[model samples]
Target: MDEFAEARAALVTLEKRKQGLIAELNDVHAAIRSQRNKLEELIRRLPVSPINRLPDEILLRIFELILIFGTPRTEDKNCCVRWKGQLAEVSRQWRNVILHSPCLWTTIRVSPSWNTARIEAHIMRSSKSPLDIEISPWRNSYALKDRPLLRRLELVVPCAERWRSLTISSVVSSSTFRVLQRLDHLSLPSLTSVWIERFPCCEPGKFDLPFLQPQRAPLIEKIFISGDIGMLKGREIPSSVKTLAVESTSLRWKITSALLLEFVPCQRLTSLCLGNFTNSEELPPNSIQLPLLEKFVSRGGVSAALICAIVAPRLKHFECHELSAYPSLHDRFVAVGGKFSNVDHLELHAGPQRSQRYKPPSQSLRLAFPGRTQARFSTGNTLKA
Candidate 1:
């Protein structure tokens, strides 16, 4: 009996020791966890990264790359509205980066595809950045009144400081000029291309917006007109004017021809493009002796007399795209012999061998080409073909 009691006491003692060891282990684990949390808290309280100490300008530049030039999706390709809006939603510094980037903000395209309010906001947000605005309004919607759009455009583009290319279009109207006729003063110093078309200025009194002397927009490189080029005749274009493109809705030759002559005064002219001016009266005002006038294009028929004048000059190109036979037109060019002295780049826009029948413009044009040989013509379709 004594031995069994002793054995039971020994077993109880061993179990008590095991239980005490487990309790100690639990206390040790709790202490370790408490120490780990305290260490983590201390680490978090320490001073932040050395990278955060960058200067504001350097940080701003980093934001600019991420917000402006980050990805193809971020770039202002065709003025994507979603990308623009997304940029605004980024961090405040990033927003500033995008707003300051002139290239990202310069172009604002107002179209049926985008929210008009959004477009307006973009324009407003651009502040002093010179705008490259392109708006093609919906067909059915009433043409935007001059007051709503032009007024806003005027606010942004005051006197054309940095505007490079401007294209203004008006929808159909019952009035003389398809829209407002008071375009006397929008001289842009940086303007390179001006294309105004489909201007329904056919009415007699409508197109005669009394001649205002050429307000100078000196850097112009290319000019295209399809609506009434009524007021520009007789006025000397700024000498910087280069390529001239004309497409008229009028079929009358007198009107189209006269306007062509007016452009001859542009002494630096290098190219002339004519579209859909058909019929007989007087040919395109005497081909301005553009010594530099290398390329000539006519989508409609070109009279033999007109071709004769072209051959007479230092033409690098004589491109006639369409031909209609007018009897006895070739007599004068052949009679004078092919004395077209300077023509080298001859492009026939029509089917084979059309130039065989027609004669180039007169040799007399060579002498008169450099001077103010204005087109004694008139028409409204100076832009629309």
Candidate 2:
């Protein structure tokens, strides 16, 4: 019995000693881990490249140029992600510079492929800089429900006060239009430029925005609308608008002189471009005079009466498409020949030749300018200006 008791006591002491050694081993491992962490922190603090020697301002300028030229084109989500990754992976210093530079994040392009986390990261990094927002989808890709894009729009809509320009090139779904309608209630005081293209077919008032009201977007000075001319049919354009562009693949309805006048405020315009306007009727007796207009461009079947109605006294440059196809309009063209008397530069595009009967007589469409005007003429295969 005594020997058995003694053996049991020895076993207890051995077990205790084993536990003590295990505790000591654990302490040693913890100390090694702490030392490794310290070494890593020290290494990070050391400068390893000569590029780090550049001043912050110089680095900022370089970053600005990179962003300016490296910005992804419309619907190019992959390029945008690659650019963000490349800039962040260079080094800790570069990453820090990119994160701290608000201008680098100010231009936000959102597509359906972008994840929520990535979009939020961009918004956070952009800070308080004025934002140039572009929302579109990849070309030739299936149009799926873009939840990420919708979420991004919801996130950025609250920041509309800081928006400098907003461009929507996507096929706006019903949900998208609903969200846009909310903008009418919000104040976009800083929004100066807006461009909307390729809007999906919707009801007459579906795409209307209150921000378009001259009272709402008082600072808006430029507007560009493409795809549908119906989008501008009944809207009252602000007098503050100086530059305007309207383009369509084909007109859904005839653009009358009154409709054209409705799109432009009574004030002088700086630059005006009208493209693919197949059917334009004559203006009313009161002409639409753009006294301060410097540049004017027209394409497709624009009416001669509409051209005659525009009295741009200071017009410097004029461009138009071939007018020979409209036989009945030949006399109208001659009547308006003297309207370009002050135009110094002209470009007439003689479009694809049809039957010889449709060919315009050389002298039938002459410009009787008081001063010499440098003119360029372009046919389908040749160019003579």
Candidate 3:
């Protein structure tokens, strides 16, 4: 019984000793945590690198410059966002700065390869800032399937009201492009610039952009239409458009005169650029008035029909590219007694023609632009002013 009593007393003593050791362990853990925090504080207080020491405003500006200058190509839709992601991963402070800056996320690119979640994330991050959206789908074999692309596009269509600039390039058939028909009746109040390129149309017919009506897009000022010009054949350019460019990049199909004339009704245009015409068609015998046109640029084979048809009293700048086509047009202009009497500057650029030799029409420059104060003429190899 005495031995049992001794064992009980020893057990109580060991329990008390174990409690004391646990208290010491707890104190050591607290000290280690405190030291770790102190070390971090010391490191932060030390002199930072030049970039890190910069004020947040300067850093933000630098980030903006990176986005502007680092873009290697226009088609690299996700390049800027990728760079932003890398920049945010550098530190917690950077992530916070980028996350809070809504302007940094305003330029949204909706490529067919991207998922719907990323698209929604961009819209959320942009907050209420005006958006510059580029919806460019992949071409040919690399293209994503239609079902996934349609799902992604569904998220972007509702955000048209926030669009400041919209570029939609579709290389697919007309049926695939019908996905955008949902945007037809939506109001685009903040939109000022639009660029549409539709390259392939297996089911070819006129594709009207009823969304571009002046009532829907009152603030639109610039319209650049390229690729298959026939797609937008019957669509009317907004009268509020200050600049209009009708160009075709396809070497396969030349822009038709009927398609070209469709934009002639933009009477309020200040700048008109027409290009990619290989065929000269007989335009309707009607003189169109461009009362406010100040700058006129003609690229590729601009038909004499268009040259003679326009009546621009305010024209000051006249530039013609692919001057190989000019000699014939110039002769036609002379034959038709065509002249821009108010043109103050004239430019002619020469291009290669396999069948014809180019001769500088110096006399035509004087006769065609009687009021020109400056003139520049280029041969295939030389520039003369």
Candidate 4:
């Protein structure tokens, strides 16, 4: 029993020593960390090197270039929200520079899922700089009562005058239209471009916002609308718009050749793209002459008769996709010869010969102009000119 008691006492002494050693080791680690941090601070306070002595203006320009070139591709796996934070983390001076530079924060991309406070900070940092705005749904679905999205829109509504470009994609909620209606009361003189792509789930003719009126966005020169062009009918699109693109899945119900004739100003259009129109029989009695049109792109069930009807004297490039099986339309286009006489490039995609589906079987694109024109063919089912 005495021997066992002695062993127990010895064991207790060793455990006490072990605890003391552990405490000493922790103290040593803390001291090392403190010393390391002090050394880092001293290093940071050292004089700037010659390479780091660039002018503030030059540094600001470099930072702007970094933001532009460092834009993450949509397919990139990394989180896009980290890009600005990563730039600021490079150094204390960089963080200060980024914070003060309003131009760096001018372009804001907001998703419904983003934190509201972060988005508010972005807007505040942008100051009075012209904003290029892009709003897309958080996931594939933007519910009608999404509070985050509504709050974000409320924050943006006050800055409508500073908006240079506005792009909204896959927004199906009725609340989106309600938010856009606020624009009707505000003048967007600086707004130059507007692009809206509605979600496929949204019913046709659901996007008839009064803000689409030409007077609200007087300076808008480029307009692209996808899904249901019906709202555009009888609505006076600005004659100053130079580029117009209309794409729809249900073209027959939404867009017609007559509607195009009534809405689009032939004299002002420089680029026109019409997608997914299945109308084969409706051709205007008189051929609409587009005097300034340089590029024309048509896709998906756009009848060859409709192609032959439009006259563009200065047309340099003509691209047609999923043309009907009517070979006579091609003959008529070649027969007229003068309709697109100035066309330097021509792209022809033949529709499926067996089935009446919209898919094309073969694509033949040619650059007929005599000069050294470079033709690049992208390897895909769709053809481009």
Give the alpha-carbon lDDT of every model: 0.54, 0.69, 0.72, 0.66
Which candidate has the top score in lDDT? 3
List residue ranges in candidate 2 displaced over 4 A. Answer: 1-53, 70-81, 91-93, 137-146, 171-184, 248-253, 278-281, 284-286, 322-324, 327-333, 336-344, 353-374
Taking the tens digit of each residue's C-alpha lDDT, what string does model 4 give over 1-385? 9999999999999999999999999999999999999999999999978636876678889877767666557744224446668878877777788889888777776565556686777789989999988776554334445555656777777888899998877546344454455444677868888887862334444545433556667777888877655566566668878888787755345566546656777788899988775554556523677889998888764554566567777788877666556653334354343455577766656565523333322221222233214333222354433
TM-score of 3: 0.74
- What value of lDDT does candidate 4 attain over all alpha carbons? 0.66
RMSD of 1: 12.9
For model 1, what is the alpha-carbon lDDT of residue 359?
A: 37
Which candidate, 1 or 3, would have the higher TM-score against the true structure?
A: 3
What would the per-residue lDDT of candidate 3 be over residues 1-385, giving only the tens digit for each residue?
Answer: 9999999999999999999999999999999999999999999999888977787888888888887666777556577878889999998878888888888888776665567777888899999999988776656413444555556667877888999998877776452365455455678988999877764442234334543577888899998877665555445677788888877766544556445656556577899887776645466433667788899888875556767766788989989888555346456455334358889998877776522355555576567688888988776766778
Choose 1 or 4, whichever is better by lDDT: 4
What's the true lDDT of residue 94 in model 4? 73
| Model 3: colliding residue pairs | none
- Per-residue error for 288 in candidate 4, Å, reads 1.5
Question: Candidate 3: deviation at residue 7, Å?
Answer: 4.2
Instruction: Estimate the Cα RMSD of every predicted model relative to the unseen true structure.
Output: 12.9, 6.7, 5.0, 10.9
Instruction: Give candidate 4 misplaced runs (Cα > 4 Å).
Output: 1-51, 76-81, 138-144, 171-185, 199-211, 251-254, 279-286, 354-385
**TM-scores for candidates 1 onward, in order:** 0.56, 0.72, 0.74, 0.72
TM-score, cand. 2 vs. native: 0.72
